[model samples]
Target: MLSLLLAAAPPALAHHPGADLDKMMGSEEKFFQIIDEPAAPPFELADADGKAVRLSDFSDKIVVLYFIFASCTDLCPIHSEVIADIQRKVNATPMKDRVQFLAVTTDPVRDTSEVLDAYGPAHGLDAGNWMFLTTRPGQPDGTTQKLSEAYNVRFEPLEDGQQMHGAVTHVIDRGGRFAAKFHGLRFDPLNMVLYINGLTNNVRKPAKPEPGWWDRLKVMFL
Candidate 1:
């Protein structure tokens, strides 16, 4: 199934990496939201260990980024599981080093370093190419949540300790271009992988075929 979807992808056209991929995904993958923006919204947050990590730090790698909190009992867990599945598929391929997965916690107040450390392994996320990020020390508790809004996603706090939000998987191309979004956990994981493969290939439009001798002769005569 994965191979078929990849095989069906349009041949790289002359242009940026996401151009052809966006066209193909628009036609075939309903869940994909093509952003194609020049620059993605920049962000600066802390990793589990309190090291400052900025979006610019990953300028050379394709980033698969998403938002989630540790305590949500609803879609967050399912979303992480879906990310885990995608990560597994991505790790099995040569694209592993070319891609990075990031999960940012919306509820940083309760998601301590301990919780962040355990969340990835607990959800089958590979720490080798993935990182769970939280708000930096002294930053407002709602910092990360506010950042989510820059990506057009909202994580609303509720009285029950659960936040209301939608599931969105953001894919940023190398060099910080906002590529696209895979909305919802129901998207076919293979499709996401294939899209990443397209980006990694750095596919460019094939050169136009030169005219044959007969065509040249015809052109000369006409």
Candidate 2:
């Protein structure tokens, strides 16, 4: 699976008091993994309006990132709908300002600006904090697909004009670290909302323990 592809990189350093916070946030252990060195591979792409958008642009917000093609008949639309549900839930809460959504096209060839622009509204995705990204005309054709691979989502074009791919929802923390991921289409959207809430409020429940010198040494070696 695409998630396995990212295992080559060293895990992100989990924050202190993570175990208590994880439980308090209601984060499902099976669906979400708190990366040790939480950071996402950076990329710059053009939105539907041709504006250059980069990951750094959202450094101050918690990013809900995913990949889809406008014409996809499977997975993409379902994922967007699920995200839309999550968006609505978040927007109803105070954490709305701290959260943002980004969907980059895997099939940039057919997902033109006009197509990309209409996709969100058609799928019930709110425009207030969401943006659909695609490669510009002069950019390489495989640009978005390469970006997907960088996020561990391997998008491959098949002869039938559809794509063979795995689905995952990436949650990038406010500080720009690729913090956590909710794998597959079946994960509850509320689970994501809870996780993002925990991130936004910096929930460090149960307090961080001060590691002893021996504990630090063990962490360095193990």
Candidate 3:
């Protein structure tokens, strides 16, 4: 059996390193309101630029995730913009390479790579660690349904071209463990950084892709 490994190198397009955050003391207190939940379901989706991304891809650090439907005229954009601000705060602090941001779209039909690519610079989202991803429709189990099911997020389309669902942000550790859930749009970036720092400095193992058949064969004693 042929075995392969995805060795670590400096990440491209969305990786930033080196930070010093002495400014976030006592900021972790507000996180008391957010509850830690079970890990989100395992799934793989494609980024706007057409590269496959899995939960494992972010096994290197804390991952910040939020769901938004790109075509919505208002709130979705504002939510993503807040995420972009979080990205900026983390990047400018002592937690640069220790975290990443994932902005996933619930609406794929109108959220193609071109569309996502266009949305970034508008909200200062073009930085490294900011990823825009989507699952093309008809991709195995219906894209929206599958992803929503994975996160336990609900989205029912309305007649006037809007969706009815809760809006929240998720923080996941390298092992894909759900760390916290921020229930609303307003939250502190300092709290997030402190949490990410906790995970990065204390993680037991760096995330690795699940061993496939070949990987198992390579380790077999037979």
Instruction: Write the residue-wise lDDT of candidate 2 on 135-220 in tens digits.
Output: 87688879889988988889899999999998888889877888877889887676677567557766545555344422332233
TM-score of each: 0.84, 0.81, 0.71
Off by over 4 Å in 3: 1-38, 136-141, 203-222
Q: Give the best candidate by lDDT.
A: 1
Candidate 2 lDDT score at position 1:
24
- Worst 10 contiguous positions by lDDT, candidate 2: 1-10
Highest-TM-score candidate: 1
Task: Count clashing residue pairs per candidate.
Answer: 2, 7, 5
Q: For residues 1-222, write the lDDT of model 3, one tens digit per residue.
A: 111111221131011111211112223344324334556566688887788888788776788888787787767788887777767656654456778888787778767788888777877884577888888545863576557656767877788877777667777877777766665666665455545644565533334323242223222211
lDDT of residue 203 for candidate 1: 56
lDDT of 3: 0.62
For candidate 1, give the lDDT of residue 33.
92
Candidates' lDDT values, in order? 0.81, 0.76, 0.62
- What is the per-residue lDDT of model 1 for residues 1-222, given as tens digits with 9 covering 90 to 100? 333333333442223233455776676589999998989889889999999999999999999999999999989899989989888877766667889999999988899999999999898889999999998878876788888999889998899989999999999999999999999988888778767876877754543323342233122212
The order by descending TM-score is 1, 2, 3
Error of 3 at 114 (Å): 0.8
